[model samples]
Target: MQNGSSLSIAERGCFHTDKFDDDGKIKRTGTWKSATAHIITAVIGSGVLSLSWCFAQLGWIAGTVTLVLFSIITMFNTILLTDCYRSPDPVTGTRNYTYMDAVKSNLGTFQYKLCGIAQYGVLTGITIGYTTTTAISMAAIKKSNCFHKHGHNADCHAHNNSFMLIFAIIQIILSQLPNFHKLSLLSAVAAIMSFTYSFIGIGLSTAKIIGEGIGNTSLTGIPIGKDFTGMEKMWKTFSALGDIAFAYSFCFILIEIQDTLKSSPPENKQMKIATATGIMASTVFYMLCGVLGYAAFGNDAPGNFLTGFGFYDPFWLIDIANICIVVHLLGAYQVLSQPFFGFVETWSKEKWPQNKLVTREFSMWGFDVNMLRFVSRTTYVIVTTIIAMIFPFFNEFVGLLGAGTFWPLSVYFPIEMYISQAKIRKYSFTWIWMQILSVACLMVSLVAAVGSTHGLITSLQKFKPFQSVS
Candidate 1:
């Protein structure tokens, strides 16, 4: 197969030519509103639920700073990526559709492969995280109701893996949807779910604080200069940074989301606007959830805010939030997994161009089905589900993947691509600043990755296979 660099200028010119309609305009399907919805859906996932614990680790001051900085950096990276999306080649009117395509066009074949590895790895990790989170949410609901009725009997523990499997089975059915653009409505629903749960969480936290004074709460983390070593504080701070960064790390799908937007003159500009609006809205929700949750629980905040609440008095509302989470993750799994499905399908097509493998059709209950998509997407969901069932450390695993890949995919690649596309000179102000940003993020990511991985490994050694996470 011809790699990006191996493709001659003539071959490059033909790229994405078919995307245009007869009028020579790119075929547009989604609006800026839908694009914003997709961005919000992609950005706010299980990560938001963990922000209170993150703030506990970092303290209010450090946590707020980290969240704001990461938000800004993420927005900058998104803008840089969208700029690369439709910047036409001098000869070819071809536009890049995927993250890997953009990397290939600007960087080369080798960098493209590297980016692909990181991109898919991150995407797969996210799918697993969602699966694990869905199961956890379901289990939380089951256990909370069980405890409320049975008064903490160990026998009442619902089989957590069973819930994971159930959700995984549900995802198998949902994954059959044909393409990402077709998921626009689901994305909008996911966005609404995100907002709904976040509002509920914030409200509950506020109610808790009002019912029981803040002074009565036991909070975690050391205030600056309060009986803690600098290294200990640094470790906690960086770990929290990883969680916040993970919350904002949605760069992988930026191009795909942008491609769904209606093609217009201010194309890149529109995307930036949508992106900014989404990020800002998400940031507000995050701050409210994190700050209020921490204030309510103090040092006792659980990694998952909902789980921490247990079966409180207003149990019905908690159940509603948990249900929303499960529903949202059902869609979230597809949002992340669709790209992986596309990757495999694209690979299959290239490897066997004339074999009619992916295109092979069959009848199932009078519905036409593509066997290749059915098998590939089903296998992907199953694998992730199995992994989630095995490990089941939702927050820890999220931090691990976020810390490991955030720098390379979210920070380094965008900066590197921007520099290459703009031909910024070495040591130039723009180049140096971008490099510094990448390096700084890389350093933090590495620290958080190592810490989270070590913590996970230790947990695994003590963890029994298929054990319930609660």
Candidate 2:
């Protein structure tokens, strides 16, 4: 008999309960709930850490409105992109496995190549950011403990590169999971961790407000003063654009997540439901965490909800929250970075379909190992770790990458694909409106990129390469 993968669908139906999909791949078991789990794992990331700061920069009015507006746009764009999962026929046509595949299927080779560069460039930035943040979280845990042991004013300095190395080693192990289909449990756990830390942050913020009273707040945000010069305020407001965008910019992996779903109930329909549900859940949490943190600290809100501000009471809880961040990022790093994984592995497999070194799987500790997967994943983790060690700025990278890729992958491509697939008349009301929306989003991304870049530059002056960041 042929190997399991080569078995005919009818044979597998008789031998196993799992049903193969149209692509003749292994049976998929992803439900809307699991897809939601994946979405949460990807969406609630380091960006969430910076929300309170973004809220502070934009203040009450713009902060609240911007969060809602981004959630709306993300939901709308993802809904459209969801329908583009399957080719000519979204529900029944041949499957497009990755974002690049979807682009090639809908748009053309020219666009596909361009999309790859933008997609992977932002993806690399994101992975590096995650590595840095994970180190910070780990370092915070140690520092929290040290402070508790020797009073709040004790020298609790901790280096982050060692923590970064430890995190990278963990990722190298978890990265062996093979694919998104195998990551359900990890994603679910990560989602729980995300909520755990988020709730803790909210609780701390609430406690501070109750015990200390409300902080200074305004409709227009922080007034120009010793805290922020006029130019600083403008740039910060612009950078906040990226922070908010980063919080909602998970559309790049929407197709990959949707691909994991069972074909029945239609992948598009289920993904749409999952996207809407996940976005709503995250939005509610973001609104609470951001708004409350802002209300508690107002103009002086910390850059990170958990560690940016002064040490919160019940120091143990603060340690737990930071620990949760580390755990959550362990899963999130894989989830967000899977798109690049799929792109590279898929291309390698197709390029050398029969090369045993690249394609052959060997059983080890009940897990399959292949050279392509091993080399590619290990290399990625190592490279990101080195970069994270060199320039460990979380907010700067998140903002810059988020703003850089916001318009193209999340907004522009989806709109362009919708127009192409629907055969809409040129310059019709719908087409004109879509074009206008894309242009508006593009302008927003440009300004955010500038602000984030400025912040990065400013940060660089104080940082030396390979210096241990605390």
Candidate 3:
């Protein structure tokens, strides 16, 4: 038998590796550089495109502080979790355990199941949000007057918008093809695209800052919007932006960490280094994007944040931004699909067999539901499609959903995993600190989701206007 091919779980619940090759000799080593790249790609996603909107909501100083704090907390929890995951069980000795497994081994099965469901929900939510973001950006680009359409040619833009949606779906399907190695490659490509946008944004922002100069003197003569008058109003705006920052940082860091760290060789340091670098790099990009965006667009930047720079042509900027977003979503789709595919693989192997005969025989009324053997695949397609369709109707609500669900995965879950696995195991000051920080992160997400959702609903109610830009 080929080496490692016969490796399996043993009677002791330990995993045994087949050491001998066909000639009874050990195989050589594999390089982990590509594996490191995967970690970085998984962390940076579509959320980066929305950082300026989040900054606008929170304002410059407050948003910066919140982002910094989130990063520090994330770093601490990740290091701790990576260290604590040194359990002696050989079955768990591999580096690439799922977040659900980490939860199970450290926090108990109940919490594991709960985290599993949440993670699934969050993954689906993210996919939907990306779809909506794509659709909205497409619509904006089409509606812009620069795309001159004499007479009924205007309807051509609408057709093109729908085509973009179909294009996005196709991209997703292509990414889901059988080549697993492609994910890491796609991730590296995404990093390149993201840096392109970040640098462009920084250059534009620096130009704006130099033109404006420092102090309230430059601020005074400018004609500000009537609604943006008071210091109280500004504070409220800043606070809302802070919530957005909380959501962005939370989601980006969490999904990246869980995917990369869990997939890394359990005792290896290389993957951890790669994962850390990815998250930190993303954080730096975010800060640069925020500063640059605010400089060019000011506070009243439009809904599709990155494309809303007043200094540039909205149409061109949006098209470029939309392209970057599509690439980023590709990475997100891969990482999210990893845990999801793993879940299906595990469940089908362990649970599907026992239920197969029963499920086939038990008809729903007179209808034979064995047709539902396709349930898992059908569920994924339908749920993803429906959520993607409905979410665009309330963009802000979906944004918050992305934030709230992602925060737990990012800020709270890793720390909890660490605390649960600490050799001391029993309660201690460090555990207490972790819990406090975890709850705080959770609360911030809760507030962001609730606030954004409320804002969305109220806006939807006041006007049902289509053809008007939000």
Candidate 4:
């Protein structure tokens, strides 16, 4: 039970070694540093881009409250899932097994499949969502003449559309390549870039707020009857809380969590610490941006707005935000695609010359493994791109996707997993509280998801209902 202790229980005689691979492979044990990095990568992503939008909706006060509440709920679930791995299996060991296995062991096949569907669906949705976001960012940053409607205002639509197409193509081709290790450095870069942009955005927003008070010139004449100035301002501040809740619901990031928690030196404590820090950093960033953006734009802020405050030309900030977001999305896709592709490859027993997991590594058996990867990668690219293009028309459709897909997966599933396992049953009071709190958070998240989806639908009706923007 001690650090790196070697013990063989009769139930788990197959996994009595201290040395291990991160994914529970029977190799070298992973160190704490890898676990920390993985955690950071797992939590940081395009979620930041949407934070401002959420803040605009819910107001800064409610937005802050939502962030805090969701962070606590999410961390609670993370700790619970990590604890589930305490009783390591002999065959798969502790470092490499997944939640699927854990759920299967506790629940029946039907429930397990249901849980898998939730997990897989959320992961796929987020992957596609981020992919689309990435394409949009790249396109925005690399504005082309074809789409540039104005001489001074470069139109990024055409270029972004083209880049998205090519990016999808490249992802499909590279997916056929089996070197997942290459993504490690990319993931780290993505984490840093995302964090930097979010942090910088926050800093800028904070400075603007402190320099120029929260009162808006646009609202100077608007009468707030019977309400004192302070009360009216407080109400205005709290208006964006729902948006914050909606944003937090989408934090059901799956791939990075799996990678971090499953790496060669799986240190659960280190991962928890890193994730906690990331969430805290993100909350502060969101609050700062929300407060400043609201002050600067006064209710006219863009839905996906990040840095648009106190700048002579706000376009540069948008461009920077776009670049950082695209990188973040790539990292997100890289992480999400791995387990999905890996699962498919393992299921098909794929083996290839270039990609052993997917090609015909051994022709003696006349089995071609790589065929599945080629097909899957191509299909995913084509299908996801089409879906992405179609869905972007719906105002905040991607944000809603995050809420619908991830809220349940990130918040509900973990609670369900823990309850099913019953490891904490001995602590009756704690167990009851867990159930109450889990259900409460789940209900709030569920409402936030549904309401946000409805809001998107209403907004779309006012925009270009069922039609592409182009």
Best by TM-score: 2
By TM-score rank, best first, the candidates go: 2, 1, 4, 3
Candidate 3 lDDT tens digits, 177-261: 3223336566677667667656756765676678774222222222346756565344334335434443343332232243333
State the local distance difference test value for candidate 1.
0.79
- How much is the lDDT of residue 225 in candidate 2? 90
Off by over 4 Å in 3: 1-36, 84-96, 139-164, 178-182, 207-268, 310-318, 353-379, 393-395, 425-427, 462-470
| Model 4 agreement with the true structure over 255-301: per-residue lDDT tens digits | 23443343433445545565566666656655666556666554455
Ranking by lDDT: 2, 1, 4, 3
- Across 187-229, the per-residue lDDT of candidate 2 in tens digits comes to 9999999999999988888988999998888887888899679
Model 4: residues with Cα > 4 Å off, grouped in runs: 1-32, 86-96, 142-160, 177-182, 203-266, 307-318, 350-359, 362-369, 393-395, 420-422, 459-470
Off by over 4 Å in 1: 1-26, 88-93, 152-155, 215-235, 361-368
lDDT head-to-head 2 vs 4, winner: 2
lDDT of 2 at 158: 85
Q: Each model's RMSD to truth, in Å? A: 4.3, 2.2, 7.2, 7.1
Clashing pairs in 3: 57-241, 58-238, 58-241, 58-242, 95-266, 96-262, 96-263, 254-410
| Higher-lDDT candidate of 1 and 3 | 1
TM-scores for every candidate against the unseen true structure: 0.90, 0.96, 0.74, 0.75
